[model samples]
Target: MTARLANKRSFPHPPHAPPADSPALSIFSPIIQVFSRELQRQPDFDLLLAELCLDHVWTEPSKRDSKGEVANKMFLSHNVLSQDFANFFIGSLGQLRSIRVVHTVSNITTSGTMFTLSCRDAAPIRDGDLTVVLGLDNSISFYSGHVKCAVAVIAR
Candidate 1:
């Protein structure tokens, strides 16, 4: 059976031109790194394309097949995606803390966790500011070949 990425993006030609690490692609570093690592687990699995928006990491694999081999691979990628999204949007305690302190491994709710992506660091965040919120879907499974990381951030 033919396989596809989570978002099922249109697969272009086979002329592979995977990106090399550069400053421009820094925000997507987390997904790229995670996807690259998974590529190693499957010798035939090459990363044809990758795009990280909000919380989901969409990719066009060099080849697609049943999700029999990369079960553990998706687990690792999803784990990193959640952490990076949280850190980039929610920030640390002093950055954007709530009255209640809750410690959990992942902030993935069924409705998708809210966090921020992209850069908003030229000026320091003041007490009152409105930022575009994004959400990442936590209950997704890339191994199932249906990864959906949908996500946001709005705070003082």
Candidate 2:
């Protein structure tokens, strides 16, 4: 089995991947709401991959770029932190396009960070489903959080 990251761990795949006809998933809704409330409390903010398809090349790695392949419909922000709750799915736009935000933060004055997930054609997140969550830090960073334990969940 191939590893999702340097760490050899896997989660539900193609099966969990939302079908082309499925609705947008809101697995990140709660997290979105939490950040929304934070924005209400603070002064402001701003913001912004894909491995939907697996490629295997021993020597020269095969990479997929949405721009080069417009026909490639499946792309996403794999919420590994959430145990792949968001799983694999067809996104309205690629991972980067999926998230949006405005920055209005300053150490002396206003402070806040909010990002919007555009699920234009995504599916609704079911109860108990996993999704991405954010982490607050002393300094701004791209991603945070760790997987205390990650057991593989391969396709049967």
List the candidate 2 regions with Cα displacement exceeding 4 Å: 1-67, 71-152
- State the TM-score for model 1: 0.16
lDDT of 2 by residue, 34-115 (tens): 9888878865444312323335211212364434323123222323344221122224343212221122343112113223
Candidate 1 per-residue lDDT, tens place, 2-81, comes to 46563345544333633455465677888988988888888886456544223662232436424322211111111322
Using lDDT as the measure, which candidate wins?
A: 2
List candidate 1 segments past 4 Å from native.
Answer: 1-23, 46-156
